[model samples]
Target: MQNPSPTGISKTVIWLMSIISGLVVANNYYNQPLLGLISKDLNVTESAAGKISVLTQLGYAFGLLMIVPLGDKFLRKKLILIDLILVTLSLLWMTFATELWMLYATSLLIGATSVIPQLFVPITAELSSETQKSANIGLVVSGLLMGILLSRFVGGIVGEMWGWRSMYGIAAALMLLIWFIVYKMLPEIQPNFKGTYFELMNSVIKLAKTQPVLQLSSFRGAMGFGSLCALFTTLVFHIERPPFEAGASVAGSFGLAGAVGALAAAKVGGLQKKMSINRIILYSILILISSWGFSYFAGDTYWGLIVGVILIDLGVQSNHIMNQTNYFLLKTNAVNRLNTVYMVSYFIGGSLGTYLASVAWKYAEWKGVCVVGLSMGLAALLAHILFADKIYKKQLNQ
Candidate 1:
């Protein structure tokens, strides 16, 4: 493949990327709100059903590690198209999944192939000028965040009215439509790395060892995401109990509150011009701590959960964009590999968070889940403070 010169990314192209990203990433979260329905339908316990979320995230982590780095070695458009086809097929299988194991299998495949958004994010950064890069990433990430939120809301409504299986059917169709659109609209970006596949994968580790900024950013993002995941993964159980006794739709509607945070992502990205990345990270961590406080006290109430969701999403998304902005600045030729390292850690954290939530829900319920989230946030804050100066010194020396 011939290397192409950098072209100015148009607003229309950004919007299209954002939409496709949103649609593709939505597959990972659709099972969140509908855990209850799936549990009942499959005649499985809540604990077992929660594995669907955990396994999906684990698969995504694996995918990020194993597949996303290929973008630097092959044409991204071709890779994305192939991944979408696999995602659509996975969703189709999910629609017919009658056994718990079957759904679990499909969930893993869906999560693995749904990493198209990660590929697109690096491409967006590559296409934009330095002046516009952060803002463009923010816009695309905003769409990705919206998809995470709206998938729950739409999944809840669709699952409530028709059935959980029907939601997968719809998702499969949407993925197919997006596959075609992306095929038609997306231009080919040539590979930047000419190394063998093994060499490209090895470079991920080399970059991680060399780049302290990448290490710190990946750690912080993972911790924050883990905290966020702990809350969303187990929220359904709390909402379905006692005072709330709400259905999936009501639980999923909380995404609306989080949607506010999604809208703020672009603005947060724009803050890069005025704020240092460390400062932004510190503020985001503080907001996450505060959100967990709200979540802890909210119990089964809607208002507290809503407020907490807004704060958590805002904190996570802002911190995430800042981290990516820093990562992109570290290397021009290795954006995709950097993304692979960062996102693999991120989804690993997410998987851990979901697992922690599941265990907490089983042993201690909502209070335990909140404690887990708060601890993760505090850990992120501590890591940032401890490593920020050291990493800065390293960067200066380099």
Candidate 2:
């Protein structure tokens, strides 16, 4: 049997994984633009529709904590295949759901199984040469990020023309094709854990408590992601009302505006090589907070939203790549565990942002949502000022 190593990992395999990661991670966001349609179809209020997103984030968080560590203990290839199948089922469930509770159930299931992309990320890291590792990881991560940035756009257009249920139906069919590609293209990894399953879980907890770099990175990443979640979750609701009175497709156009920034930030590995990671993260938080200023000043103008979307995507994507790379490079032997901790915090922040943004949208409209995004940005800035430098240096010395 061939031992697991970086050799023989072709560019074909890398691109395949990158594309799959993008397509799969989009499951979490497709509902954002569909919320209004779902609300009317299911006879639920806007607030109730908002809970679907919150539950999906919660489910994704739960899966990261519980399922990702298994990557270190089992074959990652098998895990990815299984998750793809499960997500397909969840998508169909969403397509045919008649009650609010059924929609909630399918939302959670899709979020949990859509964690397929996280499994692929570590494999790409393992398969790259030392010199090219950063670029390779960035390629795959950018695919995932683009899927996130673009899902709302696609969902909005599909929902506007074919109805929201059609979007899920289409995703379900695409997933069946994705399953075949992964079975043919993915490579196997030998298990590295030498303990019982219970011990494996314990080690993840211990690592969370012990790793200071992981702590700092997770905190800052969460805050930035929370702000991003706040904007998109409430965006369709804002754009579809008031002077605009536009449809879902128009609301989702922001995702494209956001993607322009995401595409630029895709070259983030170069940015890290030039500047200190701490300074990059600091600048990122400042950018997120400042983007909100445009949202504040532009008022009822679409130009403000367009500028804000670009800057928010730039800042948050930069913050995320920095944080993920920071903890990811810390422990080669336990990459999955490290990812588990980082991602769990990341999604919890998203869940909180979605919940709070929904509340802000419900009570105070656009202004309230802006306050939440700016508040998270300020908190991220404070996290960088207080702990980022000191903990980074302390980890370096040891």
Candidate 3:
């Protein structure tokens, strides 16, 4: 029952999808660890360079809204392949960029084309066995989380050693490699939506309006991811100042803490069979708010930052996993569309977080950034506490 969608998919292919998803998403985050370097090289203020991250996330949100739903209307392999070709080209544009506007243009396009990862995620639920569904999603999401973490670490070292452009060049080459492999190995899966493209999208909007579970899921998701986005974007600036006075590479090393958090998130995903999801969701949001308490003291020591990173990722990803699992349970036929709504909301929060954190960094420095984070974190907790019982009960009856 686990492997009979088209009957040819295997664990190896699943692992490949996980890797490809991570690689494609990495293009968005590489700018994080390199923001200071970009500010210097491009002769812009740190706030100005930070726009690159916001634009990238905004592009991703727009792409999720526009392109990811197409997975339900077309053969997913064909759509994913086309996306990769465009992704490769966009990264090349980043590699060759000499002017600031070129970086902005390429960043948006790169974010748009990187929706290939989202396409793979819906297929995992359909392709894996019922017993293994949560774990398989966990596996692929772990890869995505690792990619986000590692791109920073890699981006910093690569940018520091050679140059930021060189980091883009390497990313482009990796995409090209993955494109060829996807062309050769990926199996075709038929789409479920039969309406015209406009109708398909209209139905998505309807789902967004009607599904309270999705609404609750998306709202808190946005808040949690937004807090994380603020933390990561401003972290480079934060560490580069004061007693630490560390470099980009050291700031990027914070991904290691996130990696540990990612591991905990994956472990939490396996608890779906053993624990109540409401418990998971509540605990995760509390964890997210707790991380900010740790982040406040990061000005004094690196240890606080590391622990905070771990807690933040664990909280965000654990809640993300639970929400996504419930999204799949909403309707088997329109998982892609449900995903589109959820993720668009998720990344929009991220874009706002990036922008606000940059503003906070300008005026209040690290302390102000913590206030921004705490504000968002509290919003997530409030939303969950106010509505979780009534809404989740309604979803169960439905």
**Top model by TM-score, which number?**
1
Off by over 4 Å in 2: 1-9
Error of 2 at 293 (Å): 1.0
Residue pairs clashing, model 1: none
- For residues 1-398, write the lDDT of model 3, one tens digit per residue: 12344443478777888888888899999999999999899899898899999999999998999999999999988898888889889999998998888889888998988998898888887777666777788888888989998889999989889988999989989988997888888877898888899999898899999988889899999999999999999999988888889888999989888999988898776777677777888899899989999999665588899999999999999998888887777655788898999999999999989989999989998888889988888998898889888887876686
Worst 10 residues of 2 by lDDT: 1-10
Q: How do the residues 29-143 of candidate 2 rate in per-residue lDDT, one tens digit apiece?
A: 9999989888888888989998999999999998898888899999988888888889999999999988899989999999988888788777767666766667777778888
Arrange candidates, best lDDT first: 1, 3, 2
Q: Residue 125 of candidate 2: its Cα lDDT?
A: 71
Task: Quantify all predictions' global Cα lDDT against the true fold.
Answer: 0.90, 0.86, 0.88
TM-score of each model, paired residue for residue: 0.97, 0.97, 0.97
Residues 236-340, model 1: lDDT tens digits:
889999889999998899888899987886588766678787888899889989999899887667888999999999999888988998889876589999999
How does model 2 fare in lDDT?
A: 0.86
C-alpha lDDT of residue 116 in model 3? 85
Evaluated at residue 182, the lDDT of candidate 2 is: 82
